[model samples]
Structure formats: C-alpha cells, structure tokens
Target chain A: MTSDSSSTAGSPEENATSSSVSGATALQDVSEYSGADDDLQKEIQTAVENLECCQSEIESLNVKVAKEILKVKQNYNKIKKPIFDKRNEFIMKIPNFWLTSFMNHPEMSKIIDDVEKEVLQYLTKLEVEEFENINSGYRIKFYFNPNPFFKNEVLVKEFSLGASDQFVSESTQIDFRRGSKLRKRLRDYQKMISKAKKRSKKSEEALPRSFFNWFVENAEDSNDIAKYIKDDLWSSPLQYFLVSDV
Target chain B: MTSDSSSTAGSPEENATSSSVSGATALQDVSEYSGADDDLQKEIQTAVENLECCQSEIESLNVKVAKEILKVKQNYNKIKKPIFDKRNEFIMKIPNFWLTSFMNHPEMSKIIDDVEKEVLQYLTKLEVEEFENINSGYRIKFYFNPNPFFKNEVLVKEFSLGASDQFVSESTQIDFRRGSKLRKRLRDYQKMISKAKKRSKKSEEALPRSFFNWFVENAEDSNDIAKYIKDDLWSSPLQYFLVSDV
Candidate 1:
C-alpha cells in the first residue's frame, strides 16, 4: 500500500496513467496510507478548501455590504417620512403649487395655456432619485391625483446637473377625456414651445430653447407672495405662499 | 410736481435727501409726474421686486429638492424591506451558524470562550446609516434580542471604507449579572485581544490587530455551511453568531 501510494503520488498525470489501479485503493492511498504522499495530498486538499472558503467569505461580505446599504436607505426613509408627509399636507392645502410655479417661469409662460390655469392643481408628490457621482444628476417623478382635466397623472423629468446643458428631457403621457379642453390646450402648448424654440434660434441665442428653463425663469412672482411666504416651521414645505388661483 | 419728481429721481440718494417733502406730494410727484425719474423709480421698484422673487423661488426650489430626496429614500426603503425581512427569517432559523464559523477560524479560536459558545445565537437585525459623499462611509448598528448571557443587547461598529486603516472601532456596554460566568469570559476575551496585539507587535509583522478582522477571517467555513450560506436574498446582518446548547 505504501509503495502503491508513492507510485500513485508521482503526479496527477501518473495517477491517471495507473489504469490498473482500482478507484477505492487510490482514494484509500491518498486518505489513509502512511507516507509523505498522504501528507502532500492532505495539504493540497486543505489548500483547495481554504481557497473555496476565501471565495465564500468574500461573497458573504458582499451580501453583508448590500444588506448594510439597504439598512442605511431605510434609516434615511425613516428620518424623511414625517417631514415629507407634512410637506405633502401643506401642498395639498395650497392648490396649484407645482402648476403655478411651472407657469411662473419666463420660458414656460410662452408655451403654457393661460386657460389651463384654472384647471391646474397641486402635485400629490414629487420624488427625486439621485444616481450619485456616476451620473452626477437626478431624476424626478411628479405625481398628481386623477382629476377631471387630464388622464396622464405622472410627470417625469431627468436632469444632468453636471452638464453645461442641464436639461435632459421631461415626459408625461396624458390621457385626455373625450372633448376635454386640455386636449386642445395640450396641442396648442406643444406648438407654442416649437415656435418659441424656432423664434429663439433665429434671434441672437441660437441654443435650443429649454421649456424647463423658461418655466423656472417665468415662475417669478415677488410681491404679495414674497411677503406672505415668510420662512416658518423648518419642516412645513410652504415657507411662503404665492397668491394665485390658477 | 414734475420738476420735483425729476429732482428727486436724479438718484436713489436724492430721493432719500428730500425727506422734508410731504408724503402725499412725493407720492403724487412719483406716480403722476412726467419724465425718466418716474420711469426710473418704477423700473427700480420692479427690478427689486424681481430680485426678491428670484430669492424666494430659489428657497421654494430647495424645499422641493429636499422633499424629492425624502421621496427617493422612501422608495429605496420600500424596495428593500421585503428582501430584508426574508433574509432575517432565513437567518433566524439557522442556529449557531455564526458561532461555528467563528470557532472554525484559527485566529478567533484563540480568543472566543469555549463555555460561551453554548449561549451564543444569531443576530436579530443590522441597520446602516449613510453620510453620503461627505463622509462616504456607513455606520452599522446591530440588534440582538434580550438573552441570558449579558444585558447590553446592542453592539455598534463603524467602518471607514475609504481609509487605509479601515476599522474604526467596536463597542458594547455589557452589564453582567452577579456570579455570571460570562463576566469572566468577557474580561478574558478582552485580555486575550490586548495580549495578542502586544505579541503581534513584537514580532516582525507589526500590523495592527483588528477584532473585526478576526471575526471576518475566522467567520469563514468551507464545509456545508459555505454551501448553505449562498447569496440569494440580499439583506441579512453578518455579525457574531451564538453557539447552541453545550
């Protein structure tokens, strides 16, 4: 058995070459035989096992890291919930917060329908998802409860904060009710934006006109709203109120 | 009145100097007067108002951004909860999984008490708190249910992922009951670690000793436990596991 073990232990290739040797005897030689061959085989086995253990430990560590990330996310949400709920409540009380702001922008005013002002309401929620350094920007989803005016309740916009041209795109798939005034207003608004883009291009600034920029620029209403919108409870979403029906 | 308005409108300084002028006359001159002074005053007023509006709009936008961040955090938490719960369920069922692996580690075996093995159990939960790009690391809080061994049910460890020396520290405020064997074990473990640190320092490799490193290194087991601890569900706190009944 000793001689057989030494002979078999020459190399993995030699082990295979000993075709006459039975499988059970070979395994016994490696596991139980008293020789340097057995020690070498055991060391190899332990090393292989250690390598496997290292891989598994790393995999386990990764899972743990992922779990930690989720936990951190939950903690952030826990801290943010009450503040967000208060914001939502305040927004709900004040009608047309988002819409008024959207229209108040210098550029958006050119495209938005004046008549649609009466129909607009406050956004139910606005959520911004950050992609961190990889994207260096955020995407926001605005939610509105279903109303009589438009069926497309959700509006999504992606902004690349790092880029010179910051606006990426915004989309909303509205389902206008049959014979709704919004259907006409939507068409008119799209045309207005297209015209604005063309007109601005012809002028000194050839850059493609951004509707978001226009909305931000035009949304300025300083008088009564400014005085009324005093900075209050650090939590309440509305530090100041803007006076507008639409 | 026109001449007075022009005189007053020469500069904002002039307007201030003409304090002797009657309020009604000044108002009358500014509003009903002719020439660029009235126009200049009105333009100035409008510009100031617009500046105020711009500031307020920015404030409003900040609040909205905060709200959006909260919403995104909530979304991440919502997605993570179920997966975490499932992982908890699975981890709860596997008794002594952590303890056996810890003991299996050559370094950890030098420190962990043999008697304490029977009293050990799996962790109930782990939570991470993120500091984002500023700190760029996470702090984890581990929760363990009340058990017979010790009173301090929570253990916290902070890891700075970016730093060259990553382990910050681990702490636990354990209140041992009188005549408890765990008190001796805890003291012994601490002493063992201190001694190990001293001994390792004297040797050629003066690498700082990390308890976390011992836990991580020794927590590796390549047998059935490795296969059993496959990565499937993503949320489970990997920490010290308690041994089964002796």
Candidate 2:
C-alpha cells in the first residue's frame, strides 16, 4: 500500500514534531508541514497515502464481511425450506381440515343454526382459497359428495365480510332446487337476521347467535374475524367432516 | 454452485412418502423406496443429490465467512500500527522522561544517598532499547551529557529481575573515576542491602526501599518488579549517573 519512495523513517528530528500526529485525517493534512525540506515533504505525502490506503482497505473488508453474512443467511433459509415444505405435505393429507375447524369454533358454532349445521354435515370438502384481512376479501370453496338434491358437487363463494369497511358481497352461484337442504339453510339465515333486527329495541342489539349470522355480519371489517382464520389450533378438527354425510 | 443435473422436484406422488426428507444422510437411504417404480426411484435419487449439493454449498459459504473475518482483523491491526508508532515518537522526545519518573517514585527516593542524588541531577538522556519479560533478559540503555568525571557518556544494563529467577546483569562499560558519584551510588546500594540484612532479624526486613534497590533486588524474580518496568510511570532514573562527578 505504501507508494512513496521516501517513507517517514524514525529519527530524533522526526520524533520531535509533526510526526506525533497519527490519526488518518490528521495524517492526510500533509501540506501543513510547510517548513520541511523536499525529502521530508515526500515522506509526509507517503504517510498520508499509506493512511488512505489503510482506510480504503478497511472499507472493502467491511463490505466483504457484510456480503458473507448475507450469503450465510440465504443458505440457512434454503436448508430450512424443505423442512417447512415437508410439514405442509403432511398437513394437506387430512381431509376437510379447514371446514371442521370452522364448524367447531365456539363463536362459529353459536352463529350457525341447526338447519345449516345439518347441511354442513354433507360438506365433503371446505377450502379457504383466500382468507387474509387484505383488500381482496375472503374466497371460500366447498365440495360435496354426490347428493340427491344438488346437481353440482363443488360450491365456491366469496364474501367481503369482516375484511373491509365496505358492504359485504357474495359471489356464490346458489342454483340449488327449491326447498333442498342447502336452500332451506340459506333462507333461514336471512329470516333470522331480519326477525332479530325487528324484535330488538336497538339495531345494535341484533347480535349473531348462529354461524350464518356471523358470516354475514362479520364481513364489515377484517380485524377480529381475520385473526382467528390464521390460528393453528384448528388444524385437525375437520378429519371427520370429509367422510360424514347428512 | 450446484452441479446436480436432477434436482428435487416436488410432485404429488413424491410428496406422499418420506422422500421429502431433505437431510443428506437420510436422503442417502433411497434404496428403501425399492417398492416404488423406476421413475419414483430416480426422483428420490435426484432429491438426495439436491440435498447434498445444498449442504456442501453451505459448508463453502461458512469457510468464506471465516476467511472474511480474519481479513477484517488483519486490516484493523494495520490501521492501529501507525497510530502506535506516532505515539512512541512523541514519547521519545522527552529527555529524562523515564529517569525523572524513577527518581520521584516514593519507593526509589528513600534508597539513594545525598551524594548519589546530586550526581543524578546531571542526567541528560535515557532510553530503554528493550524491556520485555519474555525468554530473553531485559535490556536497558542510558545516555548522558559530558560531565566532570565520566569518560563514557552512555551506559547499558540488563536485568532478569521481576522476569525470572536469575541475577541482574549490567553490560555498561562503567569506567568512572574510582570514587566518582556513579561508583559511590553503586557501592552504597550493595552496602545498604548487606547492612540491612545484618541488622534485621529476618532477611525479609531488608526488602527494597528505593527504586534502585528495588530494581537491583527485584531482578531476582520478575513477579512485581517486571510489571512496573513495562509501565510508563518509571521513565529513566539512571541518566544522572552517566555524567555526575563525586
């Protein structure tokens, strides 16, 4: 790193004065040595260059250290990725995982009426395609085994409940036969909400007591409703729902 | 860094068994999948290879991280070297730095007689060429201005005191006038030790009283004496004897 031909050599005269300034910045002020001879000036310049070289080398080393730290972190993540993937594989094997969990929740159970509960027994599969509290809202997909009342087995529905401040939206194509188990459950949910509202002294007093009431009322904002969707406690509750038939 | 042609690809069937195990050692037991078809066996082999590649890459990154840490330390030392050298330059300019410090020490003041004190006042220069308590003995050097009695202006001494269990060695060519101040001081120091030994019931009672006595006696073992020798507090004390006349 030393570029100067005449580097500062320790001698009695050199030890007496400016040679004492060792800080890199102080060393860089080589022009301050106005009285020194040409040889001494060259020596001061050399010292300055040496200090600069040391500073740059230190900077480069710092960058190298940071880069190595990042590489190590990335490799560690790669090693852990497969372990996480393996866990997910095992989780996906159990049927009706999400459906049974929703049915068993105390808050969810309270909101679902007995008629809707009986129909949900025929729920061969329940999947939450999207359940985040983010702007897009929740999309739920339900699958059923061949039943006497419904022609199509899979039913998909989207709701904006409890995710945003806007009114809730339903995107399900409900074309079941009139008076079928699915239609009866759906009509009763609307009647319960309207009847409760008319009977209560205040609109606020019309609170949900069944799963259908919760699904409709909770869609107004994602805060409290979205939190329970991500919990791991409901992981294995739906194992029986995949095989049960109403 | 991956040279593997067949990397682990997650497929539905592959995810069905323990083929998801990503550790290199566990993946090596691919033969256990003998019941599976040829295609499945190939897929397992690929997964094992991918895991081994990941493990090796992580190992290489670890080595890189260690090397970078060492480089940073080496560069840091480079920056400190010049600062230390500059400090030494300033320290060297003080003429009687070490000597005056030694004369002022409370332990050193009591041992030197009046005549020796007067002679030490003439001290002009003092330097410690080497003072490490390593395998080799400690080496000390002193310089003085022209005086009324001494021919030589420089003196050199070596001591193992406070460093090892051995004798102190004075290598200086001390050809002073027979009764000169330097000779008197030396003689009195030996006399003091012997006199103290004779008068005291125990030899321990004649322990070092002055810095010189301490230096001479402490040389017997490095313990505490060797410690202060390296301290900047005891600068140069023997500088005066180099020029004093008795």
Candidate 3:
C-alpha cells in the first residue's frame, strides 16, 4: 500500500484531494512544498508520504472489513444454515455479539428497523389492554418484553444453560479482553487525527471563506463554511433538524 | 392466555405452580410444581398453577423467538436480520431459563455442552494467546495457554455510518433498553421467592425434611434449593479470580 515514492505519498484521500484541486482552469497545481531549499522540499515530501501511508493503510483496513462482511454473508448459514433455512424458524435472529453490544449501548432503543417496528406492534396488540385512565378510558397495555439485562447498568438475560449450569461463550471472554485493543485503536485514531490536523493546514488554507464559495468548493468530508468560520460569520449553524417546521 | 376462574393472581408463575399441584399429574410432565401440596395444599396448588402458566408462556415465547429466527434465516440477505438471527437462534435452542438468567445468578458456568465449549474455546483462545509466552523460535508451539480477555476489561468499538452507506445494511442500534427489561424480570423473580417464603408456614409442613432431602438432591437452581431450605443454601458468590487461572 505504500507508494511513498510518489510526490505526495499521496494517500487515497490526498490523491483524491489533489485530483479535485488540479481541475481548476488556470491554477498551477503546486508540487506540495512551495518554497525553499531542495532538502526542505524532500523533508516535507517525506512527512506527506508517511501521512499518506497511514491513509493508505486505513483504506486497506476498510477494504478488509468490507471483504469480511461479504464473506460472512456468503457463508451466513454454514454452521446452522440448514436448520434455519426456512422462514418462521426463529422469531428473533439477532446475533449474540450485536445483541450484547445492543444491550450495553445507550442508543439501542431507537435502533428499530422497519421489520422490528412491525413485530413490536404485533406483540403490543397481544398485550392485555385496559383503561389506564379510568375516567377517559385511556387504554394501556404491556407485553412479554424481555427486561434488559442492564437495568441500572446491567441486564439480566437468562442463558438457556439451565439452573446450576453456567457457561461463558468465547465471544464473552473476548469481550472483556477487547479493552486494550480499544485503547490501542483510540491511540491510533488520535495519531491519525493529529496528523490530519497538521495536514489540514493546507486544506484549511484552501478553504474558501464565504458561504457561497464554501458550498461550491470541495473538501474531504465536506467541511463547509459554517464549520470553519467563526461564530459571527453566520447567523445560525448549519444542521439538520428533525420534526422542525422550517 | 389464562382462563381458569379458580386460579389465583400473584403472577403468571404463581398460577403455573398452583395448576401443577392441582391434579396436574394428568400431564405428568407439564408442571414443575407437581406434588407440592402435602401441606398448605390449596395455596401450593394455586402457586403451582401460576408457575405452569409462566413456563408455558416462556415456552411459547421461545417458540415465537424460534419463528423469528427462522424468518431472519430466510431473509439472511436482509441488512440486519442475519446478524440478529444468529445470536438469538442459539439461545432459544437451550433447555431452560436458568441458563438464560444473567442477573444475581449463581455459578452457572459449570455446565458445558460441545457447542458452548467451542464458543468458550473461541473466546478463550484470544485470551490464551495474549497471555501465552511465545518464544520467537517456536511460533507454532501450543502449550499451557492462558484464558484470554481476562487481562483486558475495557473495549471500544468504532461505528462508521459511512460504511453502512456503501454496504447493503447497517448494524442495528444497540439494545441497552433491554437491560431494564432483564432487570425487571429478575426483580420479579426475587418477589416470587419472597412470597414463596411468606407462605412457608404452610409450605414448610408440606415440604417436610424428607421432601427437602429429595428436593436438595433433585433441584438444580440455587434459588430453588434456597426456597426449600428457607435459607441461602445455594448462593455461589462471585469470586474474582486472578487472570492466570481464568
């Protein structure tokens, strides 16, 4: 993945940036280090190359995960595939890891998909309804809702291991072990961000100041004028509002 | 689902217990509360019936989950169904709820099945490798391996909504809400235990020392034995073992 020999080491992203910038009518695409001695230019070039290397690795990692998802999809039913080859075999097909993560996550309740919403409604209808408000006959209902294991911070899921039988899956053991991996990844991300900030100096410089100019310009992740400008630049921040009248 | 007018209303569990002791032997295998009416026979009978209702409900719940799994399996190619299906699919296939119960559980880890053993192995191998001292020359050597993940307690995962943009499906939102659901069930379980103890004055006579002998021998859940003994006979406290032994 390292083509550091290239003038920019030119990461997948940087190259794309370079490509966009080169499209201007009369502008000469700079050879990266604009001024100074040959030695300085080489040094700046090396730094850029290393940053590009990181970006390259990041791109490859993305590809790797993409490939993994595809593979998992292809062999989706391999182990117990035949057992669940038909519909209505299992009402809840959530994977164990995702479920564990979901149980631990805060935004879990809102993760409902179209199908789950339908299912929830079906289950809700089964709930014995009665007037919660006696005067108004405001009906209330409940269902066989699985109490989350982490009620106060922990859920109480019953494994099917039976009484007296407790067993932890390999994934669970890994769950605990994953902390260090996370910390390391965080550090990696931090480094990436730091390097990115340094690289952003030019991108920041390239950024047009006015709102109209910013909208027409290009940037990775599309950093618009609202994000880069000071608070006084615009009367309001650019953002999407849910359930908004405007 | 309950229709018998003579039944009590403590909880679904209470009904199951009563139904069991009240000539439930006709189904023989239907009720776990069967033959618990030597003393306070009426109350015990009522309680057993409630328990039967819960057990049946749970069984029905399992059936529903199974059917869902089947759907997910059929729609394995659907964005999130396969992932959810795999995790849930394994759970309902298990024998009892004790294994499923996560909160305030005793040492349910002692039981092992081949598949679970594999899962344990899969989870443990990562830890084992981490703890294992690898001599540079012997990369292939397999020896006394440590339980993995024990050394790590913090794990962080990254989410890129961008990835979902390119893929066929995005991951479902985490299921933190279910944590409360799980806790509620546990609390309910504790309540049942409390009520069962309140009726001990009558229940104790029914469950004589002889009956306890049989119960202690046959019962698996610590809570089950605790009820019969009217003491904390089976609470296996969680012992934090060193990572070396884990």
Distance from true location, Cα of A222 in model 2, Å: 63
Distance from true location, Cα of B28 in model 3, Å:
14
Q: Is the docking of candidate 3 incorrect, acceptable, medium or high quality?
A: incorrect
**Structural similarity of chain A in candidate 2, as TM-score:** 0.44
Off by over 4 Å in 3: A1-38, A50-54, A78-81, A85-246, B1-246
Overall lDDT per candidate, in order of appearance:
0.39, 0.44, 0.25
Comparing to the true complex, what docking class would candidate 1 get? incorrect
Candidate 1 local lDDT, B12-73, one digit each (tens)? 11111111223333234333224447555565334333423433443444444444433444
Q: Model 2, B13-92: lDDT tens per residue? A: 11122212245444445455678788866765664455345434434444454444335434543554454444334334
Whole-model alpha-carbon lDDT for candidate 1: 0.39
For all predicted structures, in order, the TM-scores are 0.27, 0.28, 0.18
Q: Of the candidates numbered 1 and 2, which has the greater lDDT value?
A: 2
Q: Pick by lDDT: which candidate is best?
A: 2
Interface RMSD (Cα, Å) for model 2: 17.6
Candidate 2 global TM-score: 0.28
| C-alpha lDDT of residue A135 in model 2 | 26
User: In model 1, where do residues sit more than 4 Å from their true spots?
Assistant: A1-78, A97-112, A131-136, A160-167, A192-202, A205-237, A240-246, B1-246
| Error at B63, model 1, angstroms | 13
